[model samples]
Target chain A: MPKYLLIMRGTDESNAAMMAGIDEMIATTRQFIDEMVKAGVLLAAEGLDDPRQGVVVDFSAETPVVTDGPYGETKELFGGFFMLDVASKQEAVEWAKRVPVARGAKIEIRRVPGSDEVPQA
Target chain B: MGTVDVEAVWRIESARIVAALTRFTGDFCLAEDAAQEAVAEALVSWPVTAPVNPGGWLMATARRRAIDAIRRSVALRDRYPLLTADTPPASEPDPDRIDDDLLALMFISCHPVLSPESRVALTLRVVGGLSSEEIARALLVSVPTVQARITRGKKTIAAARIPFELPVADERRERVGGVLTVLYVIFTEGSTATSGDRLVRPGVAYEAIRLARTLAALLPDEPEVHGLLALCELTAARFPARTGPDGSPVLLEDQDRRLWDVSAVRRGLAALARASTRGLGPYGLQAMIAATHAAASSVETTDWERIVVLYEALGRVAPSPVVDLNRAVAVAMATGPERALAIVDELTVSGRLAGSHLVPTVRGELLARLGRRPEARAELELAARLCTNRRERSVLLQKAAGLG
Candidate 1:
């Protein structure tokens, strides 16, 4: 019953001041992903293409209206995320606390709804 | 052939068998003595028989030795009635019960009555199963120092009559931090020797890391356990790159990206993720900061801003001058040297890092950056004088010379 989605702001700002080459960053990111897979905590995790590719969907209208990507302020934008199944909320929090992010960058922890249902992309 | 090789392997495997025996015998001193006797027998026999199940054989033989010793000792007759009245439990044959013994021995070794140094030595001896000589070599201290620590440690535990069983949940949480602290000190000593020829002692660090991993496995539900594991893993990942070819200290900025342990970093990140399932404690926050560096390919690319933020959080949870000094560095990297220098100067005036060489070294760097060569040289010379490590002193002196 313990499922969690760890959401945080992306690396767009942090990566802006790249004194180190991007190739190294990409490689490190890949290595981090490989580690998550090996540990078996990663149900699904991915870096967004950019906030530009994202969109907001509203169901309040008769038909679903899709807003353009990068809809929110940069500080509030959804960045990267991960989903995991652990033994407890405490376990989930432990995992979230380790994510590489700016100190005050908010990490939103939400229990996945209808976890038994087929996972969506 | 040599006792050192045999002792080294025994040190690695000893805690498990000793812990198991303590549970069966319910006598800490007796169980430990029996284990040592069995090891002595192995030294003589293994060069001949070389059994495959050495640990198992040791546990079985140690139990028998404990039984025999109990029968011979009239002094223990009243105190250890259980041992004198009956044959050793047939249940000792089961290897699975070793877990309980190990848990009990861990608690006893880390009992609250002992000082942190004694706790570390005791845990390494009883729980890690290291001989005094091996531990002495590892710590780079004299054999007598190690012997004194273990003897004093055991006497303290016995005098206090600390229980031979792991505490319940609340008590476990209270003591677990102390236990973890010992392991951390051991690992840190290995990673960066307080005073030694080598920059890193892989053996000590690896032993401590292995112990932390074992504890993490034994207590899978404990968030702090994972936090410790994460911290060790992430720190260990930098081991290969922390030194130059000549064994000189490699500043974090100068370390080669390829030398870092990707696997250890990954393991650390995973552990950090697990730790996050609980509220961010000091260790977890520190691990998170390490993760920022782990995720970066080079120092410049590291998420210094995020690291600074984590340090601020860490300061709240574990307020130490050392943590503050580190945070100052991160703040400087994220913001500017001017800001970081301000903080360091404040710390200096407050006498937070009065005797520490690090504060002066950092101040020198900031002064150098600000184009104050004469002042920077003076600070570097002061740092060199205060620093204990020969290598660090050399670096500070070299920097001072360069400034001049």
Candidate 2:
């Protein structure tokens, strides 16, 4: 079995729509999580807090520049992710397709490679 | 004898204590209540001064509780004396032999009078020594639901006057089968959702294994008993590789075989050997089928011929559509898709599996293998539509799409 991290993200328009109907969205999302839990597939799931409450540190210069509050651009900003152990990338795609996201929002799935997959010295 | 020690004692001896209490009091509910009270007392007192004979201590204390409860009941005054026996702690029956009283307790808990749910709850409660809360969590039901099932089951037993004694000679085998079915149901419930609506509860399956081990020990002469134990062990051995963290099922052929539990496999095979000693019963046949898979490196390497024969025998004894459908799968693997297609077509004509997704799923696969792409796709689409499980439905749709 392989592990997949399903990252949830949305464009500005989609984010605004989610904010407008947060309760219904949350309810559906929770129901989705519950289904996974019942199926015994859910490993971890957590929604990120507002990106505005986050900070960015640019380390390009000798001294890092730290800034707080919202990013200059919210173009499909990362939201939250669910980590799951699934059979294959296809199964992960099915799960991603089932996510209760707004029309413009999309789930990006990345496979977490096994430690054993790496060549040992 | 701290709480840990008390817990250990209770875990190991609670069932026997409850059984003896039931035998003494002739009441299931009362026996359970008294046993719980005794455990509470042990929790309080065992930490200070541990008893030399822990099981006897618990049994004696529980027996006392049952007696006290009866003494307090005015209407039960006349029957009180019969409940109180003069057996000393040193005189407790030999612990090595299988206690008929404990076997009777299992029969009562899994009695045909109770619904399957009630039987599961009662079996875990009295035979496995699980608390109502634990049973609730393990079965994924509310505590109230487990309690209600247990209460209703006990009341029905009392009202029906279901005896505390074991069944007579002729019906004993059937009765034992009932008990095995309860444990099998529990294992399947814990194993996965494929069998029915139940979600996975790892604890429940392990508990069933424990109970089956207990039952196997108690019925050493009965090959089917060992057979069931083997079936549970072997099936559970695959649990490690069966599903993903998010509960997505890993198809057996695609599962990482290296992840399978070896020790469980060893134990299962041993039990299967014992089961074969008396000729394969229904459970033994199933165990043999599981054992075949267990010994295989891959589906390609599996002994499909032996499996087909085993399924044929199983169909004779268990005669279910599911068994026949499974046999068709083996037939395909052992021979070719054409023979397997014939089996599926016969089943479809019979309409024995009208609404199930399984028949069409296999039918579509067979058709696809035979290069009938359009019909295969249609069958797969129908399977997807009929399927209620989101995960399986997704797989079916994916398979259908692949045909394009």
Candidate 3:
């Protein structure tokens, strides 16, 4: 079965706005998680720490460059995610649509194929 | 061999190679023996100097070993397709058309001549490509016991002269159930243990699912094949919630449905749809029952009427005391306790499930629901005494205490 990582991203302004109303957002999100749990689709749900506390390593240069977060030129902060083992991308999209987030936040759903998907020699 | 993952490659390719060997050599025992010998030799050498092509290396080595063994066997009795020590057998069989060989291996492993234990062990070893140690640990049996069963199973096939070919049409339809039954038993062992502290044997359960998927691919037209797959997948979807954090059994009503695997539910539903095309078989009916619970928001909201109907259908297809008992439970939930009690009372009178705690336990629950406190408490107490599993006994004891 394939697993999907529902990545909810927002700009710093959006993040701050959501945090300002964090209690209600948290309540709605918990309700959303409860729905997923009842449907038996939720594998895990976790929130990311402040992006300022995160680090970024750049390998594009010959020597690796390690930069502390609030990474430069970063458009959106990739926040918390809900990992679900669901049937299709469409199903994942439906679940993602129900995520409670700030107005400016965007969610990206990525599928993780099984290790068996790698072709053998 | 520089850090080659020999075990992983063997896990994926072992069945195909062994199946092909059996087809070419026309000797099931020799083919399996040779394949193991090849893997054993690779395990010794691969870590130090890995093969450029691991699967190919194993295949060539196994064929060589089979030829050598045939030479020695020729001194006693003639075995066809005998080759000289240095020669490769006439020509390589095409691997593309190897599904028949796999199906044949499955049938032979689950041959009626062998005992149930042997069938499970043999299927895990050959078809599932599991190590004896892995099988033993998953099954809670000793490695020697697993090895003995595999060895005895192969001997039985030889003695019974089970042909290395798929059973003919009529026989194939009849015997596929025997093969599916072996996989089902293995899956049941992993998903639900009757006794012991371990509530779930994930390794065995996952292996059974992998094998079932393989069978479904091999016999795409067989509805029961998909039925077993659906049944296993749907039942396994609840595994995450089946046990609590402390590894204690969680009853169905108390389980957190949010913990179910959504992808597994989808997989099961798809398989169930395929199963229904030919009408619900025994496993399909069970899968339907599982799906009802999977889709339900809670016990109160569960479609008990539909479950009762499904169980009734299951009773007709695979009539057993357990099925009848399950139907009665559904009946109790759907309508009332009186009718369910009548069914349990009939079972009690028949003595078909004499030593099993299940009958008394169900009867106790129904009795409690009917407000027969004294009798319900007594039945639960008797059930607690009869139950061999510690966890189950604890639940029964709790029920009896609740009645009191």
Please report the candidate that would top TM-score against the real structure.
Answer: 3
Instruction: Give the TM-score ranking, best first.
Output: 3, 1, 2
- For model 3, the local distance difference test gives 0.82
Which regions of candidate 2 fall more than 4 Å away from where they truly are?
A1-121, B5-8, B40-57, B84-91, B96-98, B194-200, B385-390
lDDT of 1 by residue, B1-404 (tens): 22223454454457766776676666777877888898888888877776655545676788779878877878665546665455544444443455556667777887879987788888778766677876888888888998888778877877777778878877778878877888899889888888877777766886677677767756677788789889988888888788776788888899886777776788898888899996878888988888898889888889899999899999999998888889889988899889999888889989988988999999999899889999999999999999877777888999999986
State the lDDT of candidate 3 residue by residue for A1-91, as single tens digits: 5678999888877898998999998898887775454333566799988888989999999999998877675567788889975545655
Please provide, for model 2 over B1-404, each residue's C-alpha lDDT reduced to its tens digit, 9 standing for 90 to 100.
Answer: 12336654565567778877786677777888899999899989977887867667888888888889989988667868687657633265654422677788899999999999999999988877777888987777789999999989988988898888888999998899999999998888787655333235556787788788778767788899899989988888888777666666678878888877776788789989999996899889999999999899999999999999999999998898899899999999999999999999999999999999999999999999999999999999999899866767777899899999
State how far residue B272 of model 1 sits from its true place (Å).
Answer: 0.7
Compare the candidates by lDDT and give the number of the best one: 3
Give the higher-lDDT candidate: 2 or 3.
Answer: 3
The DockQ for candidate 1, computed on C-alphas, is 0.01
State which candidate has the highest DockQ.
3
User: Which docking category, incorrect, acceptable, medium or high, applies to candidate 3?
Assistant: incorrect
Candidate order (DockQ): 3, 1, 2
Note the DockQ of each predicted structure: 0.01, 0.01, 0.03
lDDT of 3 by residue, B1-404 (tens): 13566666666567877888887778899999999999999989987887776767888899889878877886423654444434453255443456678888889888888999999998988887778998898788899999999999989988887889888888887789999999999999888776677777666777788788778877878998889989988988888788776777789999888878777888899989998998989999999999999999899999999999999899999999999999999999999999999999999999999989999999999999889999999999999899877777888899899986
Q: For candidate 1, what is the DockQ-based docking class?
A: incorrect
Q: Return the TM-score for each candidate structure.
A: 0.73, 0.71, 0.76
Candidate 2 or 3, higher TM-score? 3
Candidate 3 TM-score, true structure as reference:
0.76
How does residue B339 of candidate 1 score in lDDT? 95
